[model samples]
Target: MPTQLLSAEQSTALGTKPHYAILDGLRGVAALMVVVFHLCETHATSHLDQVINHGYLAVDFFFLLSGFVIGYAYDDRWNGMTLKEFFRIRLIRLQPLVVLGMLIGAALFYFQASPAFPAIGQVPVWKLLLVLAIGCTLLPVPLSMDIRGWHEMHPLDGPGWSLFYEYIANLLYALGVRKFSKTALAALVVLAGAALIHFAVTSKGGDVVGGWSLEPTQLRVGFSRMMYPFFAGLLLSRVATLSRVKNAFLWCSLLLVLVLAFPRVGGAEHLWLNGLYDSLSIVVLFPLVVWLGASGHIARPGTARLCKFFGDISYPIYITHYPLIYTYTAWVSATRPTWQQALPVALLTFVTAVALAYACLKLYDEPVRKWLRRKLPVMQ
Candidate 1:
C-alpha cells in the first residue's frame, strides 16, 4: 500500500495538487459512521441510533465523491480513454468483493435453512435459486419470487441498491453522450425532475412504491433519485473548478437547495429531523470533507489507527456487515430474548465485521484491483 499520501509540500514539489487525503479521510469517517449506525440499530441503542441515523446520507456523500474523484482521476483521460477500458477498470474494482459478500450471505442464508442446523430445515428451492441468481449476476431486481421477497430479505445489504446506481452513473459517463453540453444539461434536468417527482410522491404521503415495495415504478423511481445527485455532483465539479467564486457559489447554492428541499422529501417522522443532517451531509459536507481528507489531517497524532484501519476496510464492511448484523440480531433475539441482552452480541458483530472486512481487502479487493490495473492499462 502507498504510505502517507502526498502532503501539500510534496504536491507542490511535484508541481500539482494530488488527490486530497482529507476527502479519503472523509470517506473513512463516512464508512465508520455507517458501521456505528448499523451496530446501533442492531443493539437498539437509542442514543447512538439517533446520532448515527444520518449515516445513510453517507451514500450521497459517496456518490458525490465518486463524481469528484472520477472527474479528478480521469480528467486527463476524457479524450483518450475508451468506454471499454473505463468499464473494465470499474468492474474489476467493484465486482469481486461484492460477489464475495453476496456469496457469504447466501451461504449463511442456506445454513440457516439447512437440515443439519435443525433451526432451519432447508429453504425452498425457489428461494435458493433467487439468491443464487441475484448474487451471481450482481444485479438486483425487485423480484417477487424470493423467500423474504425484496422487501424483507435485503439479500445481502439493503444499501447494495446504491451500487447499482453508482454503476449506472459510471456507464452513462462512459457513453460519451454526456459530453455534449446541451445534451448533458437536458439529461441532467430530466433526471433531476424525475427525482423531484419521486421525492414528492414519497414525501407527500402518497403511496410511491420502490425496490422494497417490489413495484417496478417504485424501483425505477428509486434508481432515478440516485442518478440525480450524481449528476448534480458532476455539474458542480465542472463549474466549481473554473473559479473560486463559482466554487463558493456552487456550494452555497447546494446548501440553499438542501434547506428548501429535504423537509419536503423525507417523509418518515423518524427521518424528519435526521433528514436535514443527511441531506447537508452530501450537499455541504462532501466539499468540506474532501477538503479535509486532502489536507493530511486524517493521520494526525490523535487519530486512532484502528479507525483508519476500519476506513480501509469500510467498503467491504459495508457490503458484508449487514447480513452478519442481521443474523447476529436474529440469533440474539432467539437465544437471549431481550434487546439489552443482545448488546454484547452486537459488539461481537462489530468486531467480526471489521475482521472480515480486513480479510476481504487483503484476500480479494487489493489483488483484484492490481490485476485490473495491469490488464486494463488505462493510465499509460
Candidate 2:
C-alpha cells in the first residue's frame, strides 16, 4: 500500500507521506468478519436471523475505503501516469488472485455436491470451463448457464461480483470521476446516498445484500450500494484532514467490529431503522474510521507485526475463502447439522479458509505479481 500522494494534513503543506497502516489491518478485520459471517450464514434459517448480523455492511465499508485509497494513492500522480499504466498496475496487484480464486472455485465445484447443489456433479466440464472463462474476465455468466440454483453472476465464486463493481469504480474514476470538482463529487455522493437510502428502506429485509446477480434490480442494488461510499471516500481523501489520535487502531477496530457485529434492528415492523443504521454507518461512520486509522500509528513491535501479517493476507483470505464456503454451505444445506454437530465442520472450514488464503498469497499471488512487475518494467 505504498503511495506517492500528498500526506493528509490541515496545513496543506508538504511533509513526509505515510500509508494508512492501521486501515490495512482494519480491512483485514472486516475480511475476517466476512469469513465468519458467511460461515454463520450457512446455519441461519433466513437472512433476517443470521448471526454476525451486519457483515454485509463490510462491503460498503470496503467501497468507502477503496475510494479514499484510490484518491490518496493515485490522484496527484496521474500527472505522470497514463490510465493504461494505472490499469496495468491495478491488474498486476489484483488480477492474479482473481484468477486463483476462480481456479480454486472451479476445482472445488464438483466436490460441493449436496442437496442444495445436487446438479454440481452432473454439470458438464464444458459448462464449468465456460464459467471459468467468463469469471476470469470478471463477466457474469448468463442465467441460462447458471449451474447453481442461485443466480449469482459468478456461481463458482460468489465474491467476484464485488470485484466486478470494484473494477467499475476504478474505470469510472479513471474516465471521468477523477476529474470532478469537489462540489460535483459531493453531489454525486449525495445522489448515491439517496439511492442507497431508497433501496434500503424499500427492501423487505431492510439490508443491502442483493448485489451478486446481474438483473436490473440487482444491478440497481449493486450500483446504489457502491455509489455513495466510493465517491464519499474519494471526497474524504481530498478534503479531510488527519490529526494525531490516541489508540486509533484499537478504537477504530472496535468501532468497525461493533457496527458489523451489531444485531439487525427493525426486523419487520420498522424496516427503516435498519436501513437508517446501514446508511449512517456507511455515510458517517466509515469515513471517521478511515480518518481515525489514518491518524494512528503502530508503536508496539509485536502488534505491528501482527497487523502486518493479517493485512498481508487480508485480500487473499477474502477472495479465496468463499469457495470453501460454498462446500461448507452445501454440506450444511444437505445435513441440516445442529450447531453441536456442525461445530467441528465449522471449525475445519474456518481453519481451511485461513490456510488456503495464506497459501494462495505466498505460493500464487506474490509470485504472479512479481512476474508481472518484472515483465512490465514500465509500470515499475
Q: Which has the greatest lDDT? A: 2
TM-score result, candidate 2: 0.94
User: Alpha carbon lDDT of residue 260, candidate 1?
Assistant: 22
Worst 10 residues of 1 by lDDT: 1-10
Question: Whole-model Cα lDDT per candidate?
Answer: 0.55, 0.83
Clashes of each: 10, 0
How does model 2 fare in lDDT? 0.83
Ten contiguous residues with the weakest lDDT in model 2: 3-12
Per-residue lDDT over 1-380 for candidate 2, one digit per residue giving the tens place of the 0 to 100 score: 23112212201212344566677788889999999999998888786788999998999998998898888877887777798888887787778888889999999998889987877878899989999999988888888878876899999888998989999999999999999999999899888888888888788778788899988889988998888888899999999987777777789999999999999888778887898888888888998998888777667766666667677778899899999999998889888889899989999999899898889988988888778767874332
Residue 136 of model 2, lDDT score: 89
Tell me the TM-score of model 1. Answer: 0.73
Give the candidate number with the greatest TM-score. Answer: 2
Candidate 1 residue-wise lDDT at 16: 49
Residue 149, candidate 2: how far off, in angstroms?
1.4
Q: What residue pairs clash in candidate 2, if any at all?
A: none
The runs of at least 3 residues in candidate 2 whose Cα sits more than 4 Å from the true structure, single-residue gaps closed, are 1-17
